[model samples]
Target: MYALGLDTTSSALTLGISNFDQINRYQTWDLGRDISIYLHQYLEAFLAPLSWSELEWLVVAQGPGSFTGTRIGVVTARTLAQQLHIPLYGISTLTAQAYAYACSLSKVNEGELIAVEYPGQRGSVYGSLFTWDASNQTLSTYKPLQYIDLKGWQQLLSTEEIHHHLSPDTVEPKGICQAMIALAHQQWQAGQQPTWQDILPYYGSLAASPPSC
Candidate 1:
């Protein structure tokens, strides 16, 4: 089965094409322009040589990242999934990052992985901690997403046994694609198909920065 994944939920724009066993990815960061334009160009270029009709699944990073970037990626993935009549899987961007971190840590050592993604707010970030099981190739105890202040981040860093870290600033599309493909396959086997209307981005509730005491 062939799956296509898009992650334009941050400063980076990632496009991934995977065939159950292998993944090919293209990512560019620091696209200081309209995200939609960059996403369209990348998708078009990436899909130019292949027939979109052959894709079996479409996966997207449902966001807690850039508001505009999340919208651009979700809308595009939704439209393409709907048009192609393929299953759509929405994976949390933070979770994807955590999974990537877990996979990396599983290779070199044994410990917990923490994934953090900047929420594009004044002084807030979104983070989740996860434990990895390399023998089974699975992740467990994924902590709920939390909105953390800079102080909270420092606390997490000092207190948590964070062996590996994955952030948008350091995450690669190749790893993201692999995680998405694996999750997509699991969803497909379980008969879970996501719809365009059901896949929405995660925008944290923080109207304004908390005032300092």
Candidate 2:
């Protein structure tokens, strides 16, 4: 089975296609503020290798990333899923970042928590905690994504003993999309079919904390 993942939650437009475990194609475009203008254009070309009918489900980084970027990506995903009559899976931007960060690590102490943070709307940073699964190469959420200032975040990290903190700046869009697809592919394989109508993006200020799922 094949699936598609799009992450326009950053200035970069990241897209990927995967067949269960392995990603077949992945690309990232640093489109700055013009992502909305070209997302569909590049997406169409990115998806040219496979027929839409071949896609099992659609996946998107429903964020706590860029406000405008997240909205654009989710709306496009919902529309495509609606038209294609397929399920749409919303992967947390923080969750994807955790996975990508895990992949970047040379050695991850499996049970130790890895924290990911993104700059938020009003001077706070969005943070989420996750535990890396070395054997499975997967991640399990330790805490739901939430918004907090740097000081509060530091306190929380100390309280939680989360040693591995990953910066949002260091991650590449390709890694984000890869992680997005992997998360969705796992859910798809498990036979959880969520509708596109229910899919929504998580933006800070509006929704400070959302369930990791």
Candidate 3:
């Protein structure tokens, strides 16, 4: 069995392929402002040598990161999933960052929380908190994903038993794709299905704040 994963929620375009147990192939390219121009070419090249017929699932990081980049990734994923008639799973970009960190560190103590913050307009950030759930062998969403400014974020962090903090600049695309693949497998096992039509991009914007210049 084969599954493909994509992470374009940030400046990088990460692609992963899982041949059952682990990610067999992982690749990333920094797309920057040319994401729309290069996304399809890169995606096609990434899967060119693979056996697409055996690919049973598609997983993508769907939001709270680069507005244009995230949209490109999701739209591409949705199109492929629909055309291929395979199940698609959407993972939150913030959660993906946290999960990636947790996986990289190997063992996160129970109660150890991970916070992911991506810069947003007007000093606000797109953030989310996740805790290591030892019993479930997975990271659980402790604080719901939200938009908070630096001061507000600091206040919220003071209330948690956080072990790590991650920001946009620190994320590793490879790790993010790995996390996406893991989450996708979990959803597949739990019988949670995804509707391509329901997938949408989340820009994590503040109503009162104007766009960052």
TM-score for each predicted model, relative to the true structure: 0.80, 0.92, 0.89
Report clash pairs, candidate 2.
Answer: none
Off by over 4 Å in 2: 21-23, 207-211
Give the per-residue lDDT of model 3 (tens digit) for 1-213: 788998888778889988776448899887788888988888778887776677898998877778888878889999988998889888887787787777666667777888888888889877788888766768788787778788999899998877888887666788888888888888899898776775666777532221110
* The candidate that achieves the highest lDDT relative to the unseen native structure: 2
lDDT of 1: 0.69
lDDT of 2 at 152: 88
Ten-residue stretch with the least lDDT total in model 3:
204-213
- Model 2 residue 205 lDDT score: 56
Instruction: For model 2, state the Cα shift of residue 141 in Å.
Output: 1.3
Q: What is the per-residue lDDT of model 1 for residues 150-171, given as tens digits with 9 covering 90 to 100?
A: 6787687778766766667565
Give each model's whole-structure lDDT.
0.69, 0.84, 0.79
Between candidates 1 and 3, the one scoring higher on TM-score is 3
Ranking by lDDT: 2, 3, 1
Q: What clash pairs does model 3 have?
A: none
